[model samples]
Target: MNIEKFDSRFEILPIKEIIDENPTTKTFVFEYPLGGKPGQFIMMWIPGVDEKPMSVAFDDGKEFWVTVCKVGPASEALHLMKVGDLVGVRGPLGTHYNWGNGDHLALVAGGYGAAPMYFVAREAVKRGCKVEFFIGARSKDLLLYVDKISKLEGVNLHISTNDGSEGRQGFVTVLLDEVLAEGNCDVVFTCGPEVMMKAVGEVADKHNVASYMSMEKYMKCGIGVCGQCAVDDTGELVCKQGPVMDWKYLKKLPEMGKYHRDAQGTKHYF
Candidate 1:
């Protein structure tokens, strides 16, 4: 395992291609090879619009992808850019998921969380680990990366949609319960909404299985300076110390799902 470092300098990279993942989401394939570890993120800047952190959706040494969901002005600007357009990228930053722990791994993904989880699944499979994916979405239209993940060599995918339009009709955590009960999970990796991750953490705790998750917070500096994304309990910066942490550590955090601070350090309900 090699630790990656960037000079804190930004790179202006051109977008090579774009794939519409859904009505509101798009995947941008970059012209440069950003060999980022799974769960690491890049700071994307759109000139005067805004800059935000996006998880590395796919990275295969030669090419990488950033999956963006149109939620705000910054992401909307990125969605409107043309193929040849260039965007300012400042990282492959932060900690990443670790592999080589166990042979059986369970992935719990909800909504766009599948993006980084897809990256994790790809690398895990190449190491000959058996991956059982539990993907959940609000409905069929919101699901992402199903085609790509299903095509992987050895992956057992179980899906659930809130409306019963996909696999079992329930939250993804429900499927995780079944997998953990079968005594098949060695480690769990999840990325999704904070509420969902908290629930997954609880379940993993009940089974005494090791689980890890990617956390999302309002970030301004992307590096550890502004203190905008610090947890209320430990004051740990998600941009520097984490974004990925173990379930045992995360479950004890007072700010895990209850509240998060904004750029002005205003606390808001999660």
Candidate 2:
């Protein structure tokens, strides 16, 4: 793996604040000079520990934020980093969601999926698109960014939780069905668990709406060298070709749900 180092000065930003979204999830805000698109992600590095890919939750050009759940070694390290601690960031990489061409945009997000969609909704509203957001989590406490997304213009926010702890008790797909039954949308965009995205894709297909999905994979090198992140069917490199892909193109990947071997040759199901 020929990983290239970015020559620009990488700033070590302090953790400004952490907002607990759920018992297991928290939104961490950091201060950093930003230049990134809505769906792009940054490689977060913890010195002497590990690095992981995290999407920018929000950005004001000078400061940015990321919402993380304590899921693994890297995330655990991130959660332990204090307000004064330093963390390395290397990107804003991957293709961004296209909001310019769509007139009525429908965004479906689940779990931490809401992080990147928050930025996408902001940009869509800024571009004068009628944006409707359908967000879901396990329960009420798992939902994040409700207050912030609600304030954006032209955004119709709908909520759902599996345990009925908040808003609607059904899956987000139910709400999407209602929305589509009521009217039509120009495009549909989503980021979430693979099953969730696949479900959303089916609905969007039925509605004849253009759909886009942000595909998540374990990444080693953020750039396209390591071959660690390859899509099954088309063999496209997620780091180079996309973390975002058209729904139609993604469905064609041969290895979509087959065997994904890790560095140790351990097979994992997608």
Candidate 3:
């Protein structure tokens, strides 16, 4: 679809509900019927604060949710706001994770990436796909969606933390590698930090499992018009062509896990 559609335009809506996921993170709910799919994101505008891309955690015809971690200015401002505060939403844009083609799914998440991955897992299990979810965080306190993900049936949850506060003490990738070694997964799905996604993508590629990754990049216009989010070498615009792409295409982009551009095209290495 193109950006000329009405849904691509911003609709200011008040926060209907807010659920605290952690001390520093909360999920904002709105009553809009976005009908968005997993891996697509919404550009959330926090009044005076700039609009930023956010993964749509859940959307079920009547209400939509966005789980935000208080990391940047826009998110910090959002955390300070209360219920009924107005915010602009203009998305469910970008590509979504692949489905229906696989029976057993492996989902990997890191930090706030857990939200988007949970969105996918919810749909995956519903489609009769057995899911193995791997969640990684610096510590238990920093993790997102552990309780919510655990409660879902047909999902085998695996967790890793650097501090050993919750699960195994190591990179979450280690858990994924171990699972892949056992050889039952049909596809791999992931969303999180670029570095972790890169490693996960490599693992999926190694196991010869088809993988879909929800990518992240600095963006302005959610459509392809903006040149701000183009991938180096390949020149694929993250906002238009991706945010979720297959491993075959993702491996072609030289900037996958290395660095990203800012609003002004400044390179920031990850």
Q: Which regions of candidate 2 are displaced past 4 Å?
A: 1-10, 257-265
**True lDDT of residue 203, candidate 3:** 91
Per-residue lDDT for 257 in model 3?
Answer: 89
- Per residue, candidate 2 scores C-alpha lDDT tens digits across 1-270 of 987965633557777888777677778887777787877888888888987888888887877888898888889887777777788888888887886744888999999899899999987787788988999999887887888898998999999999999989989999998897666688888988877888898888888787888877878877787778876656678877778788888767665534465755365876
Cα lDDT of model 3 by residue, 1-270, tens digit: 566635466899999999999989999999999888999998888898889989999888899999999998889999998999999998889899877834899999999999989988888888888999999999999999999999998999999999999999999989999999899999999988888988998998888888888888889887788889899988879898888988788887878788999889999998
Provide the clash count, candidate 3.
1
Model 3 bad stretches (over 4 Å): 1-7
TM-score for each prediction?
Answer: 0.96, 0.91, 0.95
Error of 1 at 56 (Å): 0.1
Q: Candidates' lDDT values, in order?
A: 0.90, 0.82, 0.90
Q: Which stretches of candidate 1 lie over 4 Å from their true place?
A: 1-6
Q: What pairs collide in candidate 3? A: 215-243
